[model samples]
Target chain A: MTIRSVAIIGLGLLGGSIGLAIREKLSEVTTTGFDADADVRGRATANGLVGAVCDTAAQAVASADLVILCVPVGAMGDAARGLAGCLKEGAIVSDVGSSKRSVVSALEEALPDAIVIPAHPVAGTERSGPDAGFATLFEGRWCILTPPKNADTDAVSALTLFWQELGATVELMDPDHHDLVLAVTSHIPHLIAYTIVGTASDLEDVTRGEVIKYSAGGFRDFTRIAASDPVMWRDVFLNNRDAVLEMLGRFTEDLTAMQRAIRDGDGDRLLEIFSRTRAIRQAILEQGQDVAKPDFGRGSKEV
Target chain B: MTIRSVAIIGLGLLGGSIGLAIREKLSEVTTTGFDADADVRGRATANGLVGAVCDTAAQAVASADLVILCVPVGAMGDAARGLAGCLKEGAIVSDVGSSKRSVVSALEEALPDAIVIPAHPVAGTERSGPDAGFATLFEGRWCILTPPKNADTDAVSALTLFWQELGATVELMDPDHHDLVLAVTSHIPHLIAYTIVGTASDLEDVTRGEVIKYSAGGFRDFTRIAASDPVMWRDVFLNNRDAVLEMLGRFTEDLTAMQRAIRDGDGDRLLEIFSRTRAIRQAILEQGQDVAKPDFGRGSKEV
Candidate 1:
């Protein structure tokens, strides 16, 4: 049940990283990659991101036992459909999309003959594209797999082992729950980051130059998250609308309460919430989910 | 107008950093510091955070040419009042609070005879207290000065030169304008971060463990900011109420527009805002306010 050859359908950050990780961690498993963009394919070849850089998605998946569609979530159907007749028999098709429910349905609809198991590696930097990735991108990170209930157990086990070898911890969850969790943990955060950056720049009294100069005052953190890939995030909101909107409703309500506290000068209420949130940060550090040093350890010479 | 002796009223992150920076950069200037908390005072003495860790505010400010209050904004008036009769006749009184207008008024009211020139060093880490201070904390960061109109020009120049000696770039801003500008750059961002972290941890459907495990996706960045000193933030919100509310209103409007776009499946609208925010990150990098490397260079061993 082991994956012998892996195919990456998009040579962007996620795809390129997967190929590089496989090379570094599972050299026995051959890798091939392709991107719709010719420029990216050229760079991937130069960087040796995969064992081979194919000219087309069909060519990439022709002999791969595991075919991972790494395109934006909105392009999942097309990416899957492109490999409709090219996948090897018994090939396990998967993706690394932020939202799971929509991706699960899209892949199933497009590749009915292929075994579909969607996964999301909850790790990344703000940068994108082939040059932005590294072999250790998934090190000590969580990768949740959402396989259809009727999927083969052997295939799921094999896929889980594959990710584990690439330095990721694997978990299985329902597609719907995965979407809800990510909406709170990832999607809503990115949405808010993007919104705040826009809000800061559009202010009339505070010039954009001022925002840029004094960004150490906590605004620069949002800028990093907002600088993430726009197309990937745009597709995430479009695909995970219900979960994102639900989480956004909760966040907006909480924010309004905080605003009221500020307007009313209720120092006690503000203190309570601000104090409680610090423990969550402690939990994150304890769980090895984040770095513990101050400013993400950015101030030190060695991170 | 040269400052020969400087006093610090609160030996916490901001205060302690000032002491250490002065010791490293301005070896000729003598520093005396005091904190209201006995344990912090003990720690300040053990860490050599100042040339002398005084037992009382009056003793700390006596004979000093510049006294900087580094307590919470809510405590500025009390800290200044403690130093009323101890300062030299021409000594300058300043503070390192987030909100400028309230701090300026509080200091002026508390020490009517002293030359009050409020300043805010737009630099800090989430970690606080005397032990958290570092000599390079203000390196390459901005220290904004807001002086009353009738203030002596020589005193203002001396204070500006002092901050420059501590490795911070200095800027002059009106007290009210500084409050409004910081509302967008610091206060509102902190408010939103505190709100989101609270929302994520309180969700009934999502376990706290799950939230912590997947935080790297985006939520962790907010947690770093949310982990800031609660008392400091509480005072910031209370003091900068109008500006924070105004900026929050604009942010809410932008968020609502984004929510509608998601609900209506308007991918173009989502992409537009997401794309525009990336440029702001670039501008911040160009301004040298932040590191140019990705993830604030967290991934690299050499940050």
Candidate 2:
């Protein structure tokens, strides 16, 4: 079947961004969008992000070949239940949530026989909402699809094709693997940033002021990460509690060991770890993942 | 007295950048630079960061009216002792070192008669060496000067004016306060970023690769911070051990409490801590320290 119509279940950053990218890429398809907040729906429509903005999640997914749930992971079950019945029979229902296993498990259980595919487009910033969304957010990024073994082939194919059209390199993986990987990569790092920035906030005003002013040295980078949407991160930390805590445990143990080494003037240990980390950065550079620019080239916003 | 020439010891990121910024910002002065690495002297001279690359640290400061030491904090005392006899008797001696009190304390014994003013430009990046220097690194930033009570008026005035011309807002604080402030702000945070990135690097290669790829979310920020010059940071941690460990203790306690709050699903605490953080970001914004643009923005040099 020709994919001429699609639905986006959340008009915030991820969903709105998908709408922008899809509209830019898929010339013949129409994207209908919906969000729980009416103002977001209006903003999405005004920005020409979608052809139509629907009042209800069910109405938005109707007559559409694919539906994407782009809400917080905590709201996955409720959001999936709202659209499970009205979604087109062959339409692929997927999500752009951070934690995959729980979202897929909850959404899949909410509606029987629904072709639920958990797809996470590994891209975003600390910012959120429709205004924060951009068309190129997913370009050259990885879109991971954790499709169940028994899921519909046609649905998975459609979802995969859709993401590819949006300029993403799609990879398929098991949901359990996705959660563990993301827990170490994205979830735990974000939790630590938020917690650190939160810790800095409680410092005396004079000391706190200097923290932000001299942030370019190192701390400012954490602030940018910490500035990410608290609600979204709160949900990720809560939903992926086990993996995060596990990573945090490993992280703290390593940190304590490193601190002890530093206290003991174990320069060799510090240099070894520091040098090894450089290779990971080099690998990221080789994979065309991270930039080796100057301070991420933040100093040259005008340049 | 007219300032005719300046000397920059330790031609690394901070030192080289200061040379570049000074040469770019001030038209009249001649700058003679030196580094432990002879190749760095060649690079700085070829890059026109210095009018002449001196044969040695003592040679660089021999005829100079102003000497700025930009070496790692651990090397400050040695550099000061090396140049003490060579420094022009009435010349203004300052530094861009991370810690003020320690640098001043060490230099006090080394340069007993010279007007040694400890300073920190409150700027830098992960990159290092002469190649990493930039002309505007100090533009719109703070250059903190901690002078001894009996510092000569002309010496302090000339150096303060020099940094002001480089586009920094000069601030004065007690040297000990500078150390404590930087302890909480820069040292602790760098330690955390380095620790977390180190932890992630130890993950299975497959997972580690994905972490770098999706790092844009939050982890990338830490990597950028982690990518900092390990030797310089190792020295900072070693020299500032007490203050850093104190901050570290506070951070650990805060983190454990935050972990409990998340495990308990206490959104109020999560939201409360996160909500308070936005204010610090706001304060930085008002101070015009952080750019309001997307983190590093698009078209950045990440790789």
Clashes of each: 0, 5
Q: Estimate each model's TM-score.
A: 0.98, 0.96
Spell out the clash pairs found in candidate 1.
none
Chain B TM-scores of the candidates: 0.98, 0.95
- Model 2: lDDT equals 0.79
Quality of candidate 2 docking, DockQ? 0.55
Query: Which tens-of-lDDT digit does each residue in B73-178 have in candidate 2?
Result: 8888898898867887678888898877778888999888888888898887778888888887887888899989988777778878888998888888888777
Best by TM-score: 1
- Predicted complexes: DockQ each: 0.73, 0.55
Please give the RMSD of candidate 2 to the true structure.
2.1
Fnat values, candidates in order: 0.78, 0.51
Clashing pairs in 2: A290-B302, A291-B302, A291-B303, A292-B302, A292-B303
Once fitted onto the true fold, the runs of candidate 2 whose alpha carbons sit more than 4 angstroms away are A301-303, B204-206, B299-303
